[model samples]
Target: MQMSWHRRMLAAATVAAALSISALWVAPAQPSARNGTYFYMVMYRGGRASGPVESEMTLTCFPEGGNHPDPGGACMALREVGGDFGRLKIAHADCTMEYSPVTIKVLGKWRDQRIKFIRIYPNRCLVAAMSDWVLNFP
Candidate 1:
């Protein structure tokens, strides 16, 4: 009788262990589980109504590579500016002072934090001069 009781207890323990392992496999993925930051960025002439020249594409940083054409360059640019568009370092260029505006809209997650940003540039060249090709999709 004692031997049978011991066998039952062992069987219950085995079942519990199997259930625990299955639960782990079925658990939902957390945001932090992602490889890196993800963003959907749009570069358009004038306003959003003007239509995106580069539509919206996924951009990732820190081991970068997404839909963005130059992932490595874009990630490096963001790192240089510490992910702050307003703080982008202007590159030396002979940019005209003439105003023909271009706008950029970035909306997505960065470092697991939600983000929405917008900036306007005098022209495409001026945008290119700042933050390298961070704004240039292709």
Candidate 2:
């Protein structure tokens, strides 16, 4: 059976649309929390996720590795509070009158638990002030 050109084009279009829709429905794979390895993707942006990204890094703990410069220091900071960001101690820092707001986002699995954190700081200085070093991705 010979198919017309128009019919072949229609079939291709349908397949393309189906693939696009399915891609939208697909979710990324989540890491297991029992591996004793904590991985976090940290992002610093001018606003929300849609905003321009200023800095980003991959931080992995429990072996203290990843693209992060001071992964050991960063992991130590997290360990101080048992991977609890809320309990992190903030250090004092000086800054100018600049008002560049930086939005930080963290997502990962931490020691048998899932971690998702997001906060907007008035400037980069405040993020540096956080002794936790979790948000200090450079």
Candidate 3:
């Protein structure tokens, strides 16, 4: 069957719009089990001579053999590493200790922070802090 050019263009446009909408609706992929467990640390820089002082907090998602270790669980470790300023070691069940750069941003409240890291297993991730002082797993 032969169709008019206008009709064809309209159909194409509709399909394109539908596809765009679907893409927006689709949920993001879940983080892999290997990348589940994570660590974080918060550091407060003191005076120039004093350098930086740090307070530690550990956050984990998995509860004793529940899939993979939670990213929140890793927070404490990360915080410690941060306190040391990238000199701390991170040991995982995978039995591998590696160092990678990380960025932590406070999203306000008790649990609205964002954490970003690269070349460290899972690549990119987002963590939200909760009122209970526990960070919400990504």
Per residue, candidate 1 scores C-alpha lDDT tens digits across 1-138 of 356888999999999999999999999543223754777777787855357474567777776767788888877877776677667677777778888787888876666667778888787777768757676655
lDDT of each: 0.72, 0.73, 0.35
Off by over 4 Å in 1: 1-33, 48-55
Report the C-alpha lDDT of model 2 over 19-103, residue by residue, as the tens digit: 9989878965433344655666545567675467788777778777778878888888888888777677887667675888787
Candidate 1: residue 61 Cα off by (Å): 1.6
Put the candidates in TM-score order, highest first. Answer: 2, 1, 3
- Worst ten in a row by lDDT for model 1: 28-37
- Residue 61, model 2, lDDT: 80
Candidate 3 C-alpha error for residue 110, in Å: 18
Residue clash pairs of candidate 1? none
Instruction: Quote each prediction's TM-score.
Output: 0.61, 0.67, 0.27
Count clashing residue pairs per candidate.
Answer: 0, 0, 18
lDDT of 3 by residue, 1-138 (tens): 999999999999999999998988896433233435433433223322123433333343332222223544444444554422124353322322333222332211112233433111221121222111232223
Off by over 4 Å in 3: 29-34, 37-138
* Residue-level lDDT for 39 in candidate 1: 75
